[model samples]
Structures are given as structure tokens and as C-alpha cells.
Target: MNKIKVMQVVTTDKLSGAEKVVLDIENNLDKDRFEALALCAGGELKDLYEKSGIKTYVADLSSLKPGEIKKFRSYLKENPVDILHGHDVKASIGAYIASKGLGIPVISHLHSSYPWLQGASPLKYIDRFYRKKYKLSIACSHMVKEHYLNYNKAVSEDNMKVLNNSFNFNELKEKVILPKKEMRSRLNIKENAFVFGFLGRLLDIKGADLLIDTFNKISKDIPESLLVIVGDGPEREKLESMVKNYGLDHKVLFEGYQKDVYSYLNLFDCFILPSKLEGLPMAVLEAMAMRVPVISTPVAGVKTLIKDGFNGIILKERDEANLYEAMIKVHSSEDNRVALAENAYKYLVENYNIDIYMGKLQKIYEGIR
Candidate 1:
């Protein structure tokens, strides 16, 4: 089969969900069926995109400036891209203009629950204009799809599809020849202390503060348990203050970003993702693949992944009471915790595997003209 030259456009190269998904597709996708390329707002991921043998382009469209439109449009005409796929707002608009009248399809992938698209921004009025210009619109989850539907002036629900926001599983043995003790010693946790971990940007939207409050609530019960938070963002200072305020200074340890997260995944007894919104968090998927039971709020993509009591714990409220109650229940029961972890592992292997997720994308690529 002749490969379809598919170009994925992203607004930035931040090492997060969308960029990871783009790399997942580039790595696992069949080269014979798809010639993958990327056009991103330049960053650390540029080398990886280029090394994948995918042509990488950078058009730093400050998200405004009419010149970005002209430059991206001109690039499309000269390069003759097969499918112009956009991952964020600027890229969506850029792809729309660049692919104009060429019959090349543009796919807009909505990966967030941004309120601006739902009548919050004055720009919502022209949403239909950009949405309809594309050959396809993809949401990372159903919640994102419904959110966009409310403001989709030109495109219908029938035109939008939900694509994968998957985590790429590493094939290292379940027990790597890695040292849990060294990592634990480095973090200053006792060799035998119970550890509950959270890994993501320490942003307000990610609910890092809520995690601290919840841990505080159950601190007496899990007195020996240590909380290991592993990321940094704007809310880091606020969260650090809140943790101290709750008098969890000793129990809660904030370890900023680590290059290889998997190095620390197994050190924790459980993984927590307390977010206000989401597009299928890769961190949650990583936790599952590592057989760590996940306790998270009912965010978009997460709501569809597991039942309330089945594969994972989905809390209705992100408050101290509810989150702590859920955590206590899971922590109190070893059998239940193991059951949930086993189920989560099965779910990732069966459904969210990179190969299965990217195969669906390849089929979508083949369907486009």
C-alpha cells in the first residue's frame, strides 16, 4: 500500500498528553500505510519528531499575527501535504487556511475542555467557520466532543470523532533490575513507609491542592504513608503552602519533575490524579500499566475508562471528604486494591495499547481522501 503523507500540527512541543500521542502515532504507525510528519511550535520534542523520519516544520504563529496564516499557507502549497492535521487552536486555523482549495483534508483534534470554545470567548462566534472548513474534527474524549458540540456553528456531531489519548507502555519486565531502595532513600521516605504518589503538573486545574487536603484528612489513618508529588507548575507554591497549613509537612513530600517517571511509579502503593478536567491523562494510564490502583475525579476521558467500583476508583466529589473516603477504602482493603490494579492493567493492555489506538488512527488516515 502506498503511504498517505499525514502531517500533524501542534501548537507547542510541551511534553504532555497531545505531544505524547503524536509521538505514539509516529512510532507505532505502519510506515507503509502512512508517512507521518509534524509541524509544531518549536520545543524539546523537535528532535524526536525529526528522528522518527517524519519531516518536522516549525511556524511559530504567536497564535495571532496574519503573517502566520500567509506563511503556513505558502508552506502547504509548496510541500503538498496529504492530510493536514491540527492539534490545537492556532494549528487548527493554520491548517484550515493552508489547505484551502487544495482538496487536502484538515483534521482538527480537540484535546482539552477549554471553556473558551463553549461560548466563553467572542471568537466562539466564528467557531463554525473554522470547524466546517476542516475535513474532520476529533475530540480526545466524549466530554470534549459534547463540549465542542454546544458551540459548533457549522459542523454537526456526525462530523466529529473521538480519537485516542493513549499512553505508550514500556516493555520492560514487570520487575526491572531497578532499585526501589535508592529512589526511596533519595526522597527520604523510610524504607518501609507506605507511599501514595501523584504525578502531573502542579497546576490548580490538576487539583494538586485537593490531593493535599485529602491526604491530610486521612493522614491519621495512614500515619505511616508518605505522599510523593512528582511534577511542577504554577500552583506549586500554593500547594506547598496548603500542605504546610494542613500540618502535613512531614508526610507530604514534593519532588519536582523527573525525566523518567517510570523510575518512580513502582515506588508508590497507589497513583492519584485529582483533576478538574482531562483528555485521558497519560499519567493515569501509566499508573494502570504499572498495576497501581488509580483514584481520580470524574473528569472527561477518565469517566469512560472505568466503572465507579470496577477497574478504578472514580470519586464523584474532589473535596477532602469524598477523596479521602475513597482513598481510605482502597487503602484499607488489600484484596480490593489488587483487584482494581489487575483490572486497570487488563484495560490498558486490551484497549489503550499504543498499537490498538494508533491502528484506529491509521484507518482514519486511510479513509481520508
Candidate 2:
């Protein structure tokens, strides 16, 4: 029997939640039974994918342009894949169009519940049309599955399934081995500082600004505190300006888009994600796998991942006051921090391990094939 050939199509080159999912599938797919490849808009991820020995193709799949679709269609004609697994809307749309009459199954993997999919947006109807064309739609969380079912009545339940984001604990364990003191020194962080870290795209939806506001309120309370932000995006300059305005220029460090975030996760005293929206965040899982305590606003899938005061802190409200209290609570006790990390790590081991995810994903791919 021939190995299943899968091509994961992504719109962006940056490393974020959805992009990381594509990488995970590419790296961990069963080599004996499957052959994984990537088609990306071309950026940092392209290099990373190639370096990992996966064949990666560069193309702007973020648009519905005729040339872009033709490029994808042409590529499929020359070197066909069993599955064209497209991540998110644009890439899925491109794949849906390009794979016409090619007999290859296009899998739409949704990573978030976008606002455009609600209310009376034209995009929602357009999305509804293309969604039904796919062999299957994989929602990153149950929240995303419900969101689509609620608004897009045309989509059948039989055609969709929920698969949460997962992490490879084996790979994670290796990366977290770097000495904490060495990592802190490289980033100019004090050994004893209470580091509150955020790692993701610096976008408004991610609420990096809200995190800054919450940190600004409590920075004075915790004098030896540092807010280290890893990852970069359109909001970088805006967020940096906000930090400067709060006089947190010295206290805040923006370690723009890191290829190796596990090293940073290993050093963080606590990981904070103040996102206003999310499907299921990969950063939180990475943090949990690193055995780092987490504090996050109750976004889409966060409520499922964290239990307030249990495995991690879940903010009741997305405001400076609540976040400030949560930060202070964690800062006040070392025992609380250790307990949170332990529970989080255990929860990750039982629930979101890569084997569970890969098993389900491969089943979906084979079912479609």
C-alpha cells in the first residue's frame, strides 16, 4: 500500500496557533504510513519546515486570486497529494478552488470562531458555501464547532468534528532542558525576578495591550517583576509604544518572534494570555507542557483548558483589576505556583498529548481518502 500523501496549506509564514498545528502534523505524522508536506505563504515557517526535512512549497494562498489558485492547481497536477489539508478560511478557500476535478480531498481545519462568522456578515455566507464543499471540517475546539453549527445551519453535524490543539511532550521535554539561569541571562532577566510572560502574535484580538495594562497596574507592587513578551505582529509598534507610555520601557522586553519558544517557556515564572478571542491556544499548552503556571482571560477554549485556582488561573473578567489580582495572587506564593504547574502538566499529559491528536487526525485523513 502507498503511504498517504498530505499537504497542509497555511496562509501565513509566521509561527502562531494554526501554523504550529500545521507544523505538528508535518513533524509527527506516522512516516511509515504517511508522507507530510507544507504549502505556505512563505516566511519563517517555510525555513523551519524545510530544516525539519519536510518538503515545503512557498505560495501566497491567502488570496482568492486566479493566479494563486492556478499556482496551487498546477502544483497538484504535477505532484499530487492524497489530502489538501487547508488551515483557516483563506487557505481552505484556495484549496477548495484549486483542487476542483483533481479528485483530491480538501480538508478545512478551522482554528477559531471568527466574528465574521456571526451576525449578518457577507463573509459568513461565503464561508458557509465553501465549508460544505470540503470532505470534512475539523474544528480546533468544541466552541468552534458550535459556533459554526449555530450560525451556519447548512453545515451538517456529520461533516464536522472537534479536535483540540495538542503538544508533543517528548519533543517539549527535550527543549525545556536549557538551564533557567542561562536563558534568563541571555534575555537580560534577573535570576530572582517574577517573570510574567506572553507568547503569541501581538494582535489586538490577542489582548497583549490588556496584558500591558494589567502588568502596569501591578508593576509597582512587584518591583522585581518583568513582563517578557515573545512573538511579534502588526501590533508590535503599538504595544511597544504603550509600554513606553506606561514607563514600562525598561520593565518590559519584546523578544520578537522566536523560532524556539520552548526555551522562553522554560524560563517564565508564569505564562499570561489575555486574548479577547481564541479557538484553542497552542501557547497555553506549550506553557503547560513546560510546567509553567498560567493566567489567562476566559476566552473561547481557555475555559476548557484551565480551571480557575486549579491547574491555572482563569480571569473572570478581562480587566486590569481582575488580572492584577490574579498576578498578585500567584506572585504571593511559591507553593501556589508549584501546585498550578504540577496540575497543568498532569492535565496536559492526560488530555492534550500528540498521540491522541495524531491518531484522530490520521483517522480523519484516511476516512477522507
Candidate 3:
């Protein structure tokens, strides 16, 4: 039997949720039955994938260069693939354009809601047109599916699948074996300090500024509290400025983007994701799998995973005051934190295991083929 050739395309090789999903699929997909290859604009992701012995193609995806598209099309024509799997809007557009008249099935995964493009725009219509060409549209959450459906009326329910994001629990368990005390000491954090961690892109959509403001408000009350933000983005300068303005330079630490996030997760007492919008964030799941208590706004698929005061804490609003109160409530009692973390770990093991995710994804691919 011929193996199913799948070409996974992405905008960049950055350590983001969608990129990580693509990486996981490429690494773990059935090697005997599936031929998985990754195509992206060269970056750290490319290096990581190549190091893992996965084949990758680097193309300029930042702009719609005709030469780039022609080169990609020529390669696909010569070495045909059974499917073109795209991870982001840009990659979806590129795949749709490149695979035109090639008779190849294209599957585009929607990872987040695009609220900024709510109103009228030429790019919106163009994107919608290209999105409709996808044979399957895998949404990371129900909210993500709704966002695309609202924008692109041409997409039918038959083509859209709401497959929640997942994490490798066994791998995570192995990575978190380092002693918490050692990790904290490395970061210069005291043993007794209440460390609150936020890991994601420092974008306005992620609400890192809101988290900073909330941390600033509560830092005065909690003497030994620290806010450690992981990941880097365009909003770093602005966030750093806010920390400086609030005189929180001493209390807050920006670790930037560390490849080994599990080590940092071990150091966190509580994990917070204050995103204005999200699509089943993998960071929250990773923290939960690492047994770190999570506090996040009830947005996207978060409401599905967390019941307030049950498995995890959910902020009612996106404002700093609400987030600050939630943070304090979780910080006030160690018992509550442990209980939440326990429940979260149980929930992760039961539902969001990577093995289950890969099974469902394989079924989807087989069904489409």
C-alpha cells in the first residue's frame, strides 16, 4: 500500500501553539503509513524539526511572492502529496493558492479567533475565499470554529471539526522532574515567594498588559509575590515600560522565550493566562499537566475545561481588578491551590492526552483520504 503523503505548512518555525501542534503531528504520526513533511519560513522551528530528523522546506511565507509560490507549486507538482495541511491563516492561503488545480486535499487548522478583523476589509474576504477551498477545517476549539463561520459563510459544518488542543503528559511528567527549589534558586526567587507565571506571546490579544497591571495592583499587598512572564512578542517593550512605571521591575521577571518551558513550569506556584481571546491554549494545559494551578479568563474552550472554584479558577472579567482579585483568592490559601492543581492534573490525564489527540487526527486524515 502507498503511504499517505502529508505536507504540513506554517508561516514560521516559532514556538507558538499552532506551530507546536504541527511539530507534534510531524514527530508522532505513523511513520509506516504516513509520509509527513513540514514546510515553513525558516526559523527556530525549522532547526528543531530538522534536529528531530523530519524533512522540512523553507519558503518565504511572510509575503505573497509569485516566485516563492511558483517554486512551491513546482516542487508539489514533481513530488506530489496526498494532503496539504496548513496551520495558520497565512499558510492556509498559501496552500489554497499553490494547490489550485492540483487535486490535492488541503486541511487548514484554525488556532484562534480573529476579533480584530470583525469589520469590513478586503483581506477578510480574500481569506474567506481561500478558507472555503479547504477540504477540512480543524478548529482548536468551538469558539475558533464560530469565528471562522461568522466570517466565512461559505464553510459548512461538514467540513469543520472542533478538535481541542492536547499535550504529551508522559513527556511533560518527565520534564518536570527537576526540583522546584533548584529551579527557583536559578531564577533568584525566594523559596517562600508566591510565583505567578504567564507563558504566551506578549500581544494585546493575549492580555499580557492586563496581567501586568493586575500583578502591579496586587504586588503591594503580597510582599513576597513575583510575576514571571515567559515568551516574547511585539508588546515586550510596552509591557516592560508598564512594569517600570508601576515600580514592579524588582517584582516582575521577563524570561523571554525559553525552549525548555517544562523547567519553568516546575518553578511556578500558579499559572495564569489572561487572554482577551483564546482557542484552547496549550500553555494552560501544559501547566495543568505539570500540576500547576491555573487561573484564566473564561474565554473560548477554557469554559469547557474549567468550572469556577472546581478544577481551576476562572476570572469573570478581563479587567485588572477582576484578575487581581482572582490571583489573591488563589494565593490566599495553599490548600485551595493544591486542590485545584490536583483536579486539573486529573482532568488533563482523563481528557487532553496527546495519544487521544493523535488517534482522532489519524482518523480524520484516513476519513478524508
Candidate 4:
């Protein structure tokens, strides 16, 4: 039997939610039945892909200029794949245009509901056209699928599948090499400290500033509190400046762009995601998997994963006061934190296991080809 060839195309070089999903599929696909390759728009993720022994192609996907599209098309001509699995809008459209005459099926994996995708916009129409051209669309969450469907008249329920971001709990267990005490000691955090963690790219839309503001509001009261931020992006410098301005140099720690996030996740008692927008955040899912309680804004995909005061606390609004209150409520009691964390872990095990995800993904790949 011939192995099916899949080329996972992504627009960014950073290892974020969508990129992680791409890596998961490329790394864990059945080796006997599939040959997985990656086409990264040139970033740290490309190097990691090559390091993992996967054939990787680097190209500029920042623009859909004729030259950029030609570069991609040229590569496909020299090394064709059975399927072009594009993560997000840019790569999906780029792959569709590049594979124009090749007759290879394209699959658009919608990982987030970008601002333009939420409502009718000129770019939304362009996305719809390419999405319709693709053989299938895999939304990272049901909310993401609804976002696309609510605004556009292109793809329908029949062509879209909601594949929530999944977790391999065992994989996480393997990555946590340090005990929580040792991890805290390394970060210089006191053993009695109530640690709140935020992980994900430090971007404007991620609402890192809001978290800082909320923490600042309550920092003096909770003298034994610490906020550790993981991940880096364009917004890091600005966020760091804000923390400095608030005189929170000691209270807040920024550990930029970690390759292994489990060690950091291990130190978190509570994970906060105050994202202004999202599809389904991988950070929140990781927090849940690691048995850390979550407090997040009710954004896209989050509404699906969290029920307020249930598995996690969903902020009614995105503001310093709301987030500040939520934090205080969780920090006020040990039982409250444990109950939320355990419920979140239960939900993750029941719905977001990686084994089930791969089985569903295999069917999608086989059916598409």
C-alpha cells in the first residue's frame, strides 16, 4: 500500500496554537500509512521540524505576491504531496493558489476566528473563496466553525469539522522533569507564594496588559503572590515596560518563549488567559491538563470549554475589575482552586485526548485523499 503524503503548511514561524496542532499531526501521524512533511513560512518552528527528522520547506508566506506564490508552486512541482493541509487563512489560500494545476486536494484548518473572519469584510470574502475551493475545513472549535458560517455563505456544516485542540496527558507527564518545589526555587519564587501564570504569545489581542493591571490592583494585598508570564511576541517589550512602570519588577516574571512549557506549567497554581479573542486557546487547555485551575475571559472557543464557576471561571467581561475579582475569589480558598482544577482535568480527559484526535484526523486525511 502506498503511503499518503501530507504537507502541513503554516504562515508563522512561531510555535503557537495552530503551529502546535500542525506539529502534533506531523509528528504523530501513522508512519506506515503516511508521510508527513512541513512547509513553514520560516521561523523557529521550521528548525524544530527539521530537527525532528521531517522534510521541511521554508518559504515567505507573508505576502501572496506572484513571486511568493510562484516559489511555493515551484516547490510543489518538484516534490508533490497527496494533500496540502494548510493551517489558518493565509496558508490555506497560499496553498490553494500554489497547487492550482496540480489537482491535489487542499484542507483549510481554521484555528482561530481572526477579527476579519468574525463579520463581513473584504478579506472575509477572499477567505471564503479559498475556503470553498478547499476540499474540507477543520475548525479548531465549534465556535470557530460558527464564526465562519455566521458571516459567510460559502462553506456549510457538511464541509466543516470541529476538531478541538487535544492533549496527550502522558506527553505532559514526561516533559515535567522538575518537581514543583525545584521549579519554584529555580524561578526564585517562595514556597508559600500563590503563583498565577499566563502562557501564550504576548500580543495585544492576548490582553496581557489587562492581566498586569488586574494583578497590580491586588498585588499589595496578596503579599505572597507572584505572576509568571511565559511566551514572547511583539508585545513583550511593551508589557514589560508596563510591569516596570507599576513597580512590579519583583512580583512579575517574564520567561520568554520556552521550548518546553511543561516545566513552567508545573509552577502554576492558577492559569489566566485574558485574551480579547481566540479560537480555542491551547494555553488554557494545557493549564487544565496540568491540573491548574483557569480564569479566562469568555472569548471564542472559551465559551465552549468553560462553564462559569464550573470547570473554570469565565469572566463576564474583559476588564481589570472583573479579572481582579475572579483572581481574588480563586485565591481566597484552596478548595475552590482544587475543585476547578480537578473538574477541568476530568473534562480534558473525556473530550480532548490526543489518541481520539489522531483517529479523527486520520479519517479526515483518508477521506480527503
Name the better of 1 and 2 by TM-score.
2
**Candidate 4 lDDT tens digits, 266-304:** 899899998988999888888898889999998889898
Top-lDDT candidate index:
2
CA lDDT scores, all candidates in order: 0.79, 0.89, 0.86, 0.88
Worst 10 residues of 4 by lDDT: 169-178
Residue clash pairs of candidate 1: none
Off by over 4 Å in 1: 151-153, 170-179
**Cα deviation of 44, candidate 1, in Å:** 1.2
Ranking by TM-score: 2, 3, 4, 1
Off by over 4 Å in 4: 118-122
Clash pairs detected, candidate 4: none
How far is 204's C-alpha from truth in model 3 (Å)?
A: 1.3
What's the true lDDT of residue 19 in model 1? 72
- Tens-place lDDT per residue, model 1, 1-369, is 667888888876556667767877777778777788888777767876887676888776546457776777788888887898887666787777767798789988888776676555756765567877678888888887877776665678888899757767643343353467878877777986878899988877898888887787678887888899998888999999988888888999888876577778878888888898787788888888888899989888888887778889999877777888888888888899899999999987888777777878888888986
The pairs that clash in candidate 2 are: none
Model 3 TM-score is 0.96
Better lDDT candidate (1, 3): 3
TM-score of each: 0.90, 0.96, 0.96, 0.95
